[model samples]
Target: MKVKRYVVDDLPQAVQMIRSELGSDAVILNTKEIRTGGFLGMFRKKRVEVIAAIDEASRKPAPRPAAPTKPIVRKSEPSEESAIPAVQLPNAAVRERYARSTGTSDAPAVRTSAVPSAASAVAVAVPAESPSKEAPERGAFAVPDDPRPARPVQAGAGLAENPDTASLLTELRSMKEMMVKLSKQQTFRSMPDSVMNWSRRLAEQGVEAPIIERFAEEVNDRLGTEGADDESAALSVAREVLLEWLLPSAGSGINSSTRIVHFVGPTGVGKTTTIAKIAADQSLTHHRTVGLITSDTYRIAAVDQLRTYADILNLPLEVVFSPSEAQRAFKKFEDRDLVLMDTAGRNYRNELLVSEVNSMLSPGEHAETILVLSMTQKYGDMKSVASQFAKYGVTRLLLTKVDETDSYGSILNLALEYSFAISYITCGQTVPDDIRPFDPNEWVSRLLGEPAYA
Candidate 1:
């Protein structure tokens, strides 16, 4: 075997060099990212190191044979015909035949056959040309071209007839797939230490892998390997990338024109508390006439909790037991500037429950639904709730319990994946105090564990 090593910018470059130096039959043994030419690890250049090898026997050309003596012709018996020796066809002819037989233009063509028959083995090899006028001798065998279109061959259909070729192709395919997986897995490892740490932090924060990869790519492009060593620089670049991802969904709080806002989510996500905060802000700070409605009779305390806030804020409160009653409650608050309707929190992971709660929501241009999710919840659970609500066109999001979890990637995950407009986020249970409109800058800063950027 002939082995060679190459250091290149990427896998494609290494592949091109290997093919040129070691021929097309060469296989890659291993590949990894390596850093070089740095003084005290300050300004190293990152490159891919690839090891490739090719069989020496395959690389060396076959030697020419000495001239052969003439063969003595033996007379055939009366009932026996003369048998012709098998002809060795060129590689191009064998490939053409294999392609036609398999109906695949790129099928691997091999020299030897696993099963050979007398007729096929004795067939005379010919050059690519039109059929000759003269007929063949009585005992000679010839291959005729078929005019019919080739049929599609099933996978591994011809493998049993050519085990060596099939094995080679399968091994090559496996190697290619392995290389692709390794490339993806090592993508973040190629980044500088500071940048790689942030990638890990984002993953630990529950961010999706694709989003983290894109963020890392953007940061690496901006800072490069040398500058990425500076943690501050990496954080600054990461902040900008995250902000760009989140800015589209920022400042998407409840519109002033919306008169009825329905707060919906799973249990223990602080739906009632979030309603109170928004209602208080609207009534006291914006001076809008706010009315409260609740369909939370499932838990008597749920209704009483909102009633307590309504009494303290001097806002009109209405309670409904069903969708029909909800209509009547809306009529009573028809004159109010803004009505905040709170729905009973159920296991929204169940589509039936989502539909039941969805039935009570006011559907019109004047109403909006806010899916309240707790940041402390698992990302999978949050995604499930969001997906169920999304079926009913609930695009607005209000994340609660932000102070309870250190990981905020779920916020960005929800925003980017579902395109949910994050309207508000609550850090504490304090009504109208801990809750505020979603701030992209502050949230991105927190996600990266950095101070809020200017």
Candidate 2:
């Protein structure tokens, strides 16, 4: 199989390029929207990244056969009687013994044509001089040698005693062992000690297997075997590759034109706390007028919690129970510079609930939806929640509970797998102090075991 990756402006362009380069037989393995060529996560151009592959064996034509050659003929010699002789049992006991020895039925029948002449049958049965003691006794009957060629035994034919079958079984076992070794060599096992150590570190940090292999390959490709064996050189190249992958997904916090921001995620992910942090940042740090809206009527404490933050910040708070009431809240917050809306957290793994929450938000270029995820959650569960939100066009992410987890690879995993722009990350429960815009450099440094600012 031949595999290639293409980054293009759109899916149609990627399809056209794939067809032209890899032929029509090629298929797309995966595709996601990616941002590139931005300074400090500003003015980045959005592009579609596609992974395509084709089987080389399927594309090649089969070899044609050679033309037939004329046959060579020679004169025939006078035939002696055939080496095969007819079997003639003298009595019922002899016939039964012959049948038991040869694993055949004791049916009494004889073919005269098998014996070309009586002399030929006598010569074959008598065996030139005398029978050896090791040879079994033939009681007045001759066992004919079969002239047909032996059939080849296929693999897995269950012939335990056949030498050819045993040899084939040995070869199959050797092939399986060789294939397993080759597969191990393709992964981190074949890398130099230093490079392999780095790969193990990445895996221990929760990095996906494919991403780790790609990182090891990049290290080996950029630096040769000697350089890869050097710990410092391998670490340096791995850091560069990770930074290149992460920087593109770093977001610039909140856009100026985004008037309303909807914060949505699964239950217990700190959605309300994250909203309070963002609201405080916008109002105090940026000196912008900020308002708060909560649609979390499902839980009484949720509404009370946001209201407390509103009281502390001296900001107006609006509580809405339904989509119609949400529109009224938006109308009231139209005069404000920015409005951060807090949604009720639910089991967002259910698509129905996600769509229910999405219906309450205003959709337009001025509105943005942020899916807040907890870093301590399992990557599979987080992926499920993000996938549900992605159906509703939620592309920006705000990760919470960073200090609760030791591994940070899920941040990169979400960015690369779902193509989500990580807007902010909260490290603690502190409202404004713990939250900050995602910095790709700090994150990559921390991921690579470098000391970073807390």
lDDT values for all models = 0.80, 0.80
Q: By TM-score, how accurate is candidate 1?
A: 0.64
Clashes of 1: 0
Q: After superposition, how far is residue 350 of candidate 2 from its true place, in Å?
A: 0.9
TM-scores, each model vs. reference: 0.64, 0.61
Clashing pairs in 1: none
Can you tell me which runs of candidate 2 are displaced by over 4 Å?
1-187
Runs in model 1 lying further than 4 Å from the true structure? 1-137, 140-176, 451-454
Cα lDDT tens digits for candidate 1, 1-454: 9889999999999999999889999999999999989999889999999999999899778875532233222234323333334334655665576567557776352323221233343233433431244443342223433223346657877785798988899899999999987997797677788888888889988899999888788889999757978988888888788888999888557788999999998888998988888888999899999999999889769988999999999999999988899999999888999999999989999999999998898888999988889988999999988998898888889888988878888988998999988888898988789988888989887887774431
Q: What tens digits encode model 2's per-residue C-alpha lDDT throughout 1-454?
A: 9999999999999999999999999999999999999999899999999999999989987875532232121112323322223344444555566567657675345322122232332222322332323333343243443333346646756577678988898999999999986886776566777777777878877888888878888877887856866888888888888899998899989988789999999889999988888888899998899989999988769989999999999999999989999999999988999999999889999999988999899887799999999999999999899999888778999999999988988987898889999999899998899998899998888787776642
Error of 2 at 360 (Å): 0.9
